[model samples]
Target: MFNIDLFPQALKSDENGQTRSCLLQQTTMGESVTEQELWFAYPMNLPMPEDDDCDSYLLATLLPAMQLRAAIRVHGSVSHELLANLTELQYVWSKWLPERYFLIDIQVDRIRDQDLQVESAIAAFSGGVDAQFTAYRHATGRAGYATRDIKAGVFVHGFDIPLDDTEGFNSAVEIATQVLSDINVDLLPVKTNVRALWSIDWEEYHAAAIASVLCGLKRYAGIGLIGSGDSYDVLLTPWGSHPITDPLLSCGNFRIIHDGAGFRRSEKLIILSSWSIGIRNLRVCWAGNKHDKNCGHCEKCVRTRLNLLLAGVDNPACFDTPIDSSLFRFMVLKSDAVRIDWSLIRQEIIETGRGLEWLPYIEKVLKRKSSPKLSGLFPFGSKRRMWVKKMLMRNK
Candidate 1:
């Protein structure tokens, strides 16, 4: 069994103005493994979890426990509401990815009492398309009554930007802060080594990680909004951050919402493009250097460019490099998700009678076939293309 022992130490602060909470984790497969300390850091001004608050730890450790096929024993207090939700969470994961994840036992020392109602919310923001859409829609009242009272945008360092990239993180946070500030929202910066410290797969485990981090602010807000990557129409399952699994991560009065699943990426871009601050400062490239802006050559960059062009933004300033039809020759539709994204653009162009010149390039990229291994040569690195193809196809 894996054990996460919450030491009674107060939150620690360093000269760098960062405050962090730590927990000692010990895992046993057959023989005992080495002990490791898991920690999450936030800016000193942000609200953090109490010393004995174990909800975050419980959620953070679930994926690891399932990966090890070992039950978990928590030596701290966890929210009774969260404990109940975890049962359904395990069942869903086990059913979805039986080959890699399994249901595991979870035992807690004591159940933490629930809090009074909390109405404010904080969203997980990476200054990406989905995140901007969630933030803008609610802030601008475009979501109508369904909009949340988003208090701040939580930007994490170690999630997409590496923990070691201080300069890069600072730069990204500056852009995020600017984007959020324009919407009358604050930016809460957090730093963590969760991904670097663990051996778990990131694609399937990222949502839980986001939940764990945001749960730290449960004292300040009752709701956490995780911006949805794909709309409900083209839902991506067996991957991380699905609508079905995101809500299950909620515990006690703190609710987890998978926001912006109702709108397609192009639709979201149209809404955001109308906003001067959001469209001008948008940051979505994942293949470039951590410190650099959009590379304009990656598949994602090209797709975003296409989305902007379709939105009638002839030349968006967010991307320094211009996307041309010649770039599609080097592009590869690695996963069905990528193919679907481009296909949607093609369909939208036909429907709107705009950007028709790029139709041939999009068709060629989707139709051309290549070995999965060849995808490694691309900028964002390689994935199990064939396996993802099968999973998405089967699920659809």
Candidate 2:
């Protein structure tokens, strides 16, 4: 059995005058695994309910790893409805990735729906295209919500940046603060070692991780907006963050909204291009270093640069250097998401009668195999090899 204990909330202030409210945890699984005093810290300056509610915090922190162990004992209050939704959501998630399927036993007190209180609206802001688009639309009243009602933007250090990297964490805070400030929104930073505590597939469990962070702030934020990674039109199965799974994460007073599903990657850029802050402070590099904002050579950075160029708003403010089309010659488009984005960029080039300049790179990408097939690993007959090649070409 896996036991999780949520200790009473504690308030602490740093030397810099910033205050943090923390919900600390202690987890143990027999003699194999033991995590003591793990914490989820939230900025305390933001508005919060009169009563301390640790239900949302427990759900967010323990749900992802519950299945890995046989049973979970959460010593905190949780919503009965939210618990049911999470149970069902886990079923759907396991179906998509059978390798991760495992039975989970849950034990916790349930909070009645009538006792829930209202909370302010907030979105996860990472200074990326998807997050920026969500913040811009919701904060500008373009999404039909009052601009001022959306209270603040939440940034998590352990999600993208490692928990131990103080330099990266500080840089992300600096960037997120500048971006949110330009839009007249407060920045709420949360620090946690949740990812380090739980050993799960990052791609498959990131949605749960993100939702947990938002839920941890449920006392302050009622509606948590999670930016969509892929648009609804081309949404593939087995994705961590989807329109279906995100909304189910809501319980009692806190609701998780999967924002920006209606817009494509290209369309989102067009919307963000109108905002100077979005253009000037966009950070999309997965290969970014602690010293540099964007490495300018990674697959993600190259893709974003191409999309910005195709959108007609490519500038030094957004990227340190111009789009190096030659980089495409070396990049192998692996995932469906990257391929889809490249396809859209390809169509844009063709429509603008600029295909000749990019034809070589596009053809190279099309000729490359789709993810490696089993046949590539073992010696196979010509017939099987030929079939795999055709499938790869057809996918392109």
Candidate 3:
């Protein structure tokens, strides 16, 4: 068993005082490190300032915190070695951290149950098709009691930022707000930077945050929600053995995480369109250059553009650069699609079986593109996965 003392100081540093992302795991020398641990640490009461604004807590604290939990759990066995050196660890964290936060988010409800006068319910506000559908349901009161009464949010802290100056998230927030407003559910946006400690796993990451929410609810029951939509169906972790584990279940991240059962990307665009989400207010680029316009060449920009095109909505401000046709081909083959395929580009992982992690997602989207059997289809796409998978298997 290998354990990294993430809290301990590193042995050396580069020109900058910045501690490399690697944690030193002091085991009896010569023991091959197996299991990995990593988590992001933030100051306590980080979300207190915006307790009333659920969106702030969810975006700033919950989303980032939960993603750190997912990273420790999902990629533990696969990237355990990524934690070997400080500079190496930082490099891996640079990519892995953002992937973890891809669609992480949360929602809250303070309601009166038969047994208790007041209880707190927490759900993820995944910016995907499934989450969009759930938000719609909460709006019209399809099931029981009209409208979801949620008020908080979360994210993998700085995970929202891009590795390089690539793009922005204006559109994402605009879509999110439009969804919340329709359902009368207040969306809280929180930013999290919990992946700083890469030695701890997802369980502990959520334990701290979930624990914080539980504390926030005080006497009320703490609820962690898993929601619906098409993106949920496409993701392997959304349904199976995700890294989040019990922490995802403590209040339960499983309950709300549905598999492609609700909304599609097209419908979401239509809904947002109805709300008049202008191109400038929406952001989907994640290149790290906040001021720079979207790098249409990146996988993310292309995907967003394709989704919008399929939806029949036109707005150029969201992404200024016209995506190169070659860039689209590269993205189709996993160029810069994060969370879904970003892991494939990792220098080390690319040499392995999962050539580009997004191959599978691309495969899913391809099957749905321009298909006669498809219903309510707009457009989100992918491919080149079989060849990559075959190559990855051959190396072994």
Candidate 4:
């Protein structure tokens, strides 16, 4: 168990740009390396918020990174193998290993102890719908596929999620605790004072950056990179980009399995709506007002509301907020709006019509299947099962 209690409450930056969160007692491990120190500082793509919501866990989550400073007097073989692939090993350990250690304790049917194991699963569990659904899907199974070899765990990083809002992380943690109730696992929390660094607007591929260090340092199978996928796939902004779209942007080492493509944002909401989720507990606004609830007027809130409405799901107990129809209007007016060719996409969805409209486009973008193009300029991805999938999606 990686104990985070010993981590310091504050840290200072050096002239060379290395951030040390613990001021009083400098880390006794990995002191000299540049990348190691950065990981120890804060394993987040964005700057952390300096506020009440920030706590020791953020500082502690940087422990693997903290090991770079120096070895504390703790006695054990520190198999830094975990450093190479944070998410994958995390999955390995949290999900597979425990089941290996104690089989009778769990409700096992398909998974076997001899099949596989992970060091741990990388997780910054946010209590929102997408995160919840992703975790739930991982736990339940994927398309009738039992996760006999898979595991889930949370690796706390200190960055405040709600654009500097303190309670943003707390709500996420609280909800995550409730959601991960069945899966017995450890919360490897880290405390790193990294609020200032996350403030920078242009962060492209922090997941890859974080996962690489975890993979390189650890001898785990790979890292598990989790993302809703839709946020980046749809939104093009000045500061951020989607992990799936730009895997090459960061240092690639660990195998990142982003569950973004498992389902659409709308589809997730539709499925989640059917299940007994504490819908009132979800928060979508990035504005950092937990008490204010989901501002349905905001772009994020409106998107969720629209998804639920389209799916014909009941609205949960909502705090007072209005959905702005104009936002959807403006969003849809785009040249590449999702329904810009509703007719085109719609025609492809018919029983006789193959889902060629967006399926091909999605396949090419997701690198799910390969297409023949003119030159290197045109990307031809590997086509896994072109006809069968098309038949299924089109109801053919």
Best-to-worst ranking by lDDT: 1, 2, 4, 3
Q: How high a TM-score does candidate 4 get?
A: 0.46
In model 2, the runs with Cα more than 4 Å from the true position are: 1-33, 47-54, 61-63, 66-69, 145-148, 351-356, 370-396
Worst 10 residues of 3 by lDDT: 74-83
lDDT of 4 at 117: 29
Q: For each candidate, what TM-score against the reference? A: 0.90, 0.82, 0.44, 0.46
Q: How many backbone clashes does candidate 2 have?
A: 0
Taking every candidate in turn, the Cα RMSD to the unseen true structure, in Å, is: 5.8, 8.2, 15.4, 16.8
Overall lDDT per candidate, in order of appearance: 0.79, 0.68, 0.35, 0.37
Deviation from native of the Cα of residue 356 in model 2, angstroms: 6.0
Between the candidate structures 2 and 3, which one is better when assessed by lDDT? 2
Of 3 and 4, the candidate ranking higher by lDDT: 4
**Per-residue lDDT for 1-396 in model 1, tens only?**
554444424678776554545565565656575666667877666666677777887788888778777777777678888988999999888888898788887877788776654679999998888899999999888988888899999998877776656898899888888889888999998877666666676778899999988998887788999998888888877878999999999998799999999988888988888888888877888656544367677689899999998888877888876667777986787676677788899999999988999989888888887438443332121245334534644552
lDDT of 4 by residue, 118-176 (tens): 34344334445665566556555642652322344443444324223346555565555
lDDT of 3 by residue, 169-284 (tens): 34444456664665465454333333332323432243333333322232222344444322433443322223233223232111222222334455456555544433343545
What's the C-alpha lDDT at position 87 in model 4? 30
Candidate 3 Cα outliers beyond 4 Å, as residue runs = 3-147, 162-191, 199-221, 226-248, 252-260, 278-280, 291-294, 321-332, 335-396
Query: Number of the top candidate by lDDT?
Result: 1
- lDDT of model 4 at residue 118? 39
Count of clashes in candidate 4: 61
TM value for model 1 = 0.90
Clashing pairs counted in every model: 0, 0, 67, 61
